[model samples]
Target: MTKAQIRQTYDRIAHWYDLIEAIPEFLGVKILRRELLQRASGKVLEVAAGTGKNLRYYPKTCQITAADMSSAMLEIARSRADGLGLDITFLIMDAEALGLHDQSFDTVVSSLTLCTFPDPVAAILEMARVCRSNGRILLVEHGRSDRERLGRWQDRRAERHAARVGCHWNREPLKIVLKAGLKVIDARRAFFGIFHLIEAMS
Candidate 1:
């Protein structure tokens, strides 16, 4: 789907997005998010911050900015932040071409977003560009499984799955990060190697 189409799709489902993923969030995604975000510090920017799911995981001392391509999704995120009593800046912006200045943030983050981006590498590069030299980029992303059979099953249904939700579930998250030219600090996979927790230096 085109970026505009993806935005519209997300907007249409913004209200239900959290509920739809509740099972997985409860199962393990939430834990991964918390573990990955604890490293964030100083000026932090979360790209594609859908529904602000990561808001409560951040340290209270960090100044946070959350951005997404879909305004409707961002609105929900803003409300979530408000409910959490956390002051956060919310913006409607594309991850591939962020409007923020270069190297303006001490940490950059994104979660479960690479699958849906039209240009995942570009999005990662943008995250790197907005991050300071010594800054860290944290990610919690899901892709193909490590098990051959499960990966094959995902590949077979990848197109259909993407057609429904714009998520290319078969993409490789770690490879995309490397393609973006960031220096990898650490990378770990969980849940049959479908979910990746990656830390990188810009």
Candidate 2:
């Protein structure tokens, strides 16, 4: 999808996104976000920080810069930050082309966002690029399940799902990490191998 389409699609769904998240099916997602964000430290940047779902999980001592392409989404994130009494810097930015400095953050993070980027590799590279040499790139994401039957099901509905939700649910997070040449510090999976929690060094 074109950048405009992506921004527009997410903008339209920004409000509903959190509502859908409230469904019981997504409890695991919240658990994953909390588990990953708990590790964030020092200067942190969260790309595509949709609705600031990871905001409350941030450490009070950490400085956070939350970014996203959709302005509407960022608005929601800003409000969430305010309600949580967290001082966060919010910016509207395209994940593929972040307007941030290189090697500036001590920790770079993104959750459940890679699968939607039109160029997932470029996005991963951007995350790696902004992280300092010793900084970490942490992510908690869901992708194609290891099960063959589910893999086939994802393949069959991938196109339609992407068109509607602006995400490719069947992507392989490990492959994208490898393509980015990130040094894997740790990696694990949950939900029968559908959710990947990866921590890699830049």
Candidate 3:
């Protein structure tokens, strides 16, 4: 989809997105934010930061720039940031084509977001491109199952579900990060191997 179309699609879904995605989404965000906090330091860039769900978990001393493609989602994020008194810069930006300068941030974070990108590989490469050489990039995503049967099921359902909900279920995000030239420093699979926490160095 074009960027405009993607934005509109997400905007239309913004209000209902959190409500419909409450359970696994909440748990996943919680897990990811905790993991990110352990390694996060210095200036951070959070891509596709829908509704700023990860904002509260960030340390008060850290500076954060949160970006999302959808304006509606960002509107909600801005309100949440203001309500929490968290100083954050919110921008309407694309993941594949970040407008920031190279090596701009010490840490890059994406929580359950890679799977929704039309070109996840390019998005990840951009994350690495905008991160300092020693910076860490953390991701928590749901991917294709390791089990043959479940993997096949995800493969069969992913495209249709993606079409309906703007999310992909079968993305191999860990492999994509490695392919983007980041070195994997740590990885853990949870929720019956459906969810993953990956820490990579640029």
Best by lDDT: 1
Which model is ahead, 1 or 3, in terms of lDDT? 1
Worst 10 residues of 1 by lDDT: 21-30
**For model 1, which pairs clash?**
none
Using TM-score as the yardstick, the better of models 2 and 3 is 2
For model 3 the local lDDT of residue 8 reads 88
Could you estimate the TM-score for every candidate? 0.98, 0.96, 0.94
TM-score, model 1 to reference: 0.98
Which order, best to worst by TM-score? Answer: 1, 2, 3
The reply for model 3, stretches above 4 Å from the true place, is 26-29
> Which tens-of-lDDT digit does each residue in 1-94 have in candidate 2?
7779989988998899888767523747778778888889999999999889889988889999999989998999999999999999988888
Worst 10 residues of 2 by lDDT: 21-30
How close to the true structure is residue 67 of candidate 1, measured as C-alpha lDDT?
92
Considering lDDT, where higher is better, how would the candidates rank from best to worst? 1, 2, 3
Worst 10 residues of 3 by lDDT: 26-35
